[model samples]
Target: MATIQFRLRSKANKNVSIKVRLSIDRNNVFELNTGFSINPKDWSETNNLPKQTTPENKLLSSDLKKLDSYIIENLNTDLGKSILIDSNWLESKINDCFSRVVKTDTSLLINHIQHIIDNANTRKVKNKIGLSASTIKNYTLFRNIISEYQKKIKKQIQFIEITKPFVDKFTNWLINTKNYSTNYAGKQLEILKTVCIDAEKNEIQVAPYSKIIQHFRESEKDRYIQTLSFEELELILNVDLSNIEQLNQFKKENPELTKNLSITPESLNNVRNWILLGCEIGQRGGDLLEITRENIRYNGKNYYIDLIQQKTNKSVTIGIIAPHVIDIVENNLPKKIPHQKLNEYAKVICKLAGIVEVVKGTKLNTETNRKELGNYPKYELIASHCFRRSFASNYYKKIPTPILINITGHSKESLFLTYINKREDKDANADLFMQFYEKLNKDKEPQLKIIKSGTND
Candidate 1:
């Protein structure tokens, strides 16, 4: 068993800092230096003296010695370093550590991550992978890719001692053999790098994954994932809410509401409200879902949604009541639910509203044939992130791009511009038709005035 020892370091100013050192031996060690903090109100330096001064300290006496003996017996290994610590030994050590310092079960990545993930089945992992899903998924893929490559190449190398060259070969295999996107292969390589970091912390110096600079194809300029036309956008906006069929359906399905439009409609008013909530607020899924009734209120006469963004950790006080968005908000008090449930609800609602493709990137316009577009009319590629993308897309087209970027908390224009969809030529033609109509009706009656926009008056 490795011991975690603590020590005091007194600086030149006579200020003391605590240092924690972890060591499997006197030779190999890692340390954490904690700086000083302000003293708490109730703690007294003199009053805490007796335990330090006398034999009254029971911690250094019996309990620590007993613990030391128990740990020594457990670690009575006349063993040499073998291939990555065997499962039984690793699990026992981790379990022992968990029992001793129970607060942080994941202090050591190798102990907690590898032992658990290596032994568990997919079902067990699916149930228990906490904030660790993204990490494990990549390593598991790397492991598979390596295994497959080894069989074909008849590599004279063991995977545990896999070198940088091997990693390069594996990455190439993932791209060429697996038919994976280079971007995805790059992501897996990055994840492999992290796993190597974890391995380093455990003193298992995995040869650097590779030395190759990551190469990615330039993303196409007009290869926008979103292609909503001006008419489609208008159809979404000018939907007749008082439709008798919707009312009848609402009466039948009292607790839930559904839409009838072929395109994405603002069905389930509350969920649509949340979708619009994401649109105007321009936050990641978690941040947008954190909005509550209190965070929204009239500041004199203007409405605002004020909440901390989840990913950026920055305060966002934007209006969800923007003219482009407000109609979806249901006028009522708010309710609280767990973040997970709310996120799940957002997913369900996004799909039900015909916005699923845009949310998941499961499908894209460029990927589909135009001839097949009608059958898959609602086949737009959407993702949970598409809310932020759509918000940026529309705002970039209608407003200043820089202002849109700032409002959405994007730090770079080029990175953000990728989210902006291209203008469809079909929509440009529609606007041209509108101009022609206006020209033809130059000397017309009030019937020519079907307003698609609001008047300042």
Candidate 2:
């Protein structure tokens, strides 16, 4: 059981600071500041009430009594009984009381979201590191966009006031007014939904807008899953950047391509080797570029690349079997390549290798600042992601699905297949059904019968 009573600090002037003293089991005790000061002459020590008959004193007395009763009521509730009665619990209850009594609208939509962002930025996860810097930046961007939306509408909204219509309007505003792409707009809404979920966990009021948020899912049509074929991969690998004289002669022959080929022979070779390693291992740019001598392990017969995936934080060990992969590991184990520069150099390398076959894909038109889907030369669509997709696509059927899934860190077969853009053709379809058909008829004997034709009769 707990007891609550009002007490006053020493007088500084005509008034003294007042606070509530809480005691549990007659042993544990703590004081909570009420942020109130009252004249000592007006306070009655006998009844623990203000002696003044004025409206202000009457209201103050009634508030104090109500606050005491609220604490008592809460102590009897399920949550109160489950939690240990302590200073922290008392402080939280006091805050809840103040929020309900003083600031009834503290849990407004934008206000609570801002609170969540602030909390998230300070939270520590995994090895005591704070939220990812990129994530914090995104949260700042989300807040700014929401602020703009509020200003444009000339209206402030509370959490309870949010509805499905509000979500639709905000989404439309992001797309039509802000000129954001569908996928980008959907990401913004997804961040908002995440904040709402966090807010709900903190007991902040939020409208049920998850159903509306589900409608703004990122569309698959907006994504471009491009990859390099075995031939294209070979083309990139075979590009001889080693002979500087030949490269110089080739540059002179194609003066227009000299600007892209201005990189030093050594730098070009480094980028080439990095791309080959990425293709062979199927690692993301972040994970692939960061590999070093320390990440390589040898068990006498075979070498392996062991590292934790940057995005999923799952540890994976990929076997190094390809001759080119083994060569890169033996020679350039600790190579350093910037991800952005790698992507840029990869495009140039692919172009120099004559991998200019036109293909249907998405390319960003810098002049128009929008992604346009059309037929583009294969080199134009080359990026670090292509290496991962290429690795997945090239060896998908050759390797066992479970083992491949382990190497790729993919949890689902459908997602893995989609990542590689695999499809069922006539041969593959027939092969799949044939296995089941053969098994079903394995125990049954052949049942062929001869039929006489009408002409023969």
lDDT of each: 0.49, 0.76
Top TM-score hit: 2
**Number of the predicted model whose lDDT against the real structure is largest:** 2
TM-score each candidate: 0.45, 0.64
Q: After superposition, how far is residue 149 of candidate 2 from its true place, in Å?
A: 3.1
Quote the positional error of residue 135 for candidate 1 in Å: 7.3
lDDT tens string, model 2, 199-220? 6777777778742465364345
Error of model 1, residue 256, in angstroms:
19
The list of candidate 2 runs beyond 4 A from truth reads 1-140, 154-157, 210-212, 215-223, 243-262, 422-457
C-alpha positional error of residue 440 in candidate 2 after TM-score superposition, expressed in Å: 20
